[model samples]
Target: MSTERAREGLYSRVQQFHAEQMQALDSGRFEEYAETFTEDGEFRHSPGRPPARTRAGIAKELTAFHQERFAGEAVQRRHWFNMLNVQEQADGTVHATFYVLALLTRPGERVPEIAPSCLVRDVLVEEDGRLLTRSRRVEHDHVPEA
Candidate 1:
């Protein structure tokens, strides 16, 4: 394959990877979602909070947060990623940036509630021929109150 063609293919693969990863997360597959990252991957959400380090840590944090957030309700969160920009680095790592919309729906609700949109940046690396996230940072468009 030509260089340009190979890059395009890589971009498509990266987008597919994000889709699968987000689906796993929305489906409440915590472990599976965490597995999308490298073993020692880092995940940062918003500002002023410490980043979750390592796959186990990421899974633990997500499980607790999700459980508490939807405690007694059967709420579903649908994540939509758009305007993805994927770039391959000379060092062989892939950088991806995209905007994500989180839609929340509850039982008997006709319309899903939209959460704050976020911009996500990710660094992906190939491990054992599988693409895995090396790091991720999510910045919400809404400003949090103190």
Candidate 2:
């Protein structure tokens, strides 16, 4: 295959991976979402806050966060990604960046509200023929990062 074709293939794979991962999170499958990350994966939800390190730590935090975010509420959060840019790094890792929109839908609401739009950067690696996120950083568009 030509280099361009190979690159497109990788991009497609990354896009599919993100869709599945986000769906897991949206469905309250925190463990399944965390499993997409590497064992020592790091996730930084914001620029100021420290990253949630490790797969187990990520899962724990997300579980607590989801519970708190929707406490006594019937709201669901869905993640949408767009304008994905994927690059094959020299070290064999894939770098993917995209805009993420967090939409919140209430029990009786017909339309979902946009919570925040963010720019996410991720470093992905393949281990045992499986793609896993090594690190991720999220920058909210409305918030000024210091």
Candidate 3:
């Protein structure tokens, strides 16, 4: 494929991967959410301290974290990505960086609260004709005071 075409294909794959992750999160499918990554993938949440080093770890940590943080609070959450920059590696892997905005809506709240935007850095590899994340880093653009 030409350079342009290859870039376009990578872009589409990243977008699809992001969408699938958002869907998993929205539906509270923690296991599916974690499965979006490779078996040894890692998810590092900025303010949360320790990182999830594996898919199982991600599911366990995220499930407990979300429950503790937002338990019993009916809310709508949406994660959006913008300004994605994708690069194809010599080994055929892809790396991308983008900004993320997370909007949260709570019951009785008039407007949704926007989590400070963050930067997402991802490394994805094509395995068996499928794109899978090998590493994901989420850095807070602005962290709220606790």
The most accurate candidate by TM-score is 2
Q: Spell out the clash pairs found in candidate 2.
A: none
Q: Write the per-residue lDDT of candidate 1 for residues 92-133, one digit (tens) a residue.
A: 999999998899999999899998799889999999888999
Model 3 has an lDDT value of 0.84
Which residue runs does candidate 3 get wrong by more than 4 Å? 1-8, 108-110, 143-146
Worst 10 residues of 1 by lDDT: 1-10
Q: Return the clash pairs for model 3, or none.
A: none
Q: Which 10-residue window of candidate 2 scores lowest in summed lDDT?
A: 1-10
Displacement of the residue 102 alpha carbon in candidate 2, Å? 0.2
Candidate closer to the true structure by TM-score (higher is better), 1 or 2? 2
| Residue-level error in angstroms, candidate 3, position 17 | 1.6
Question: TM per model?
Answer: 0.89, 0.91, 0.87
Candidates 1 and 2: which is better by lDDT? Answer: 2
- At residue 30, candidate 2 shows an lDDT of 89
Q: How much does each candidate deviate from the true structure in C-alpha RMSD? A: 3.8, 3.7, 4.5
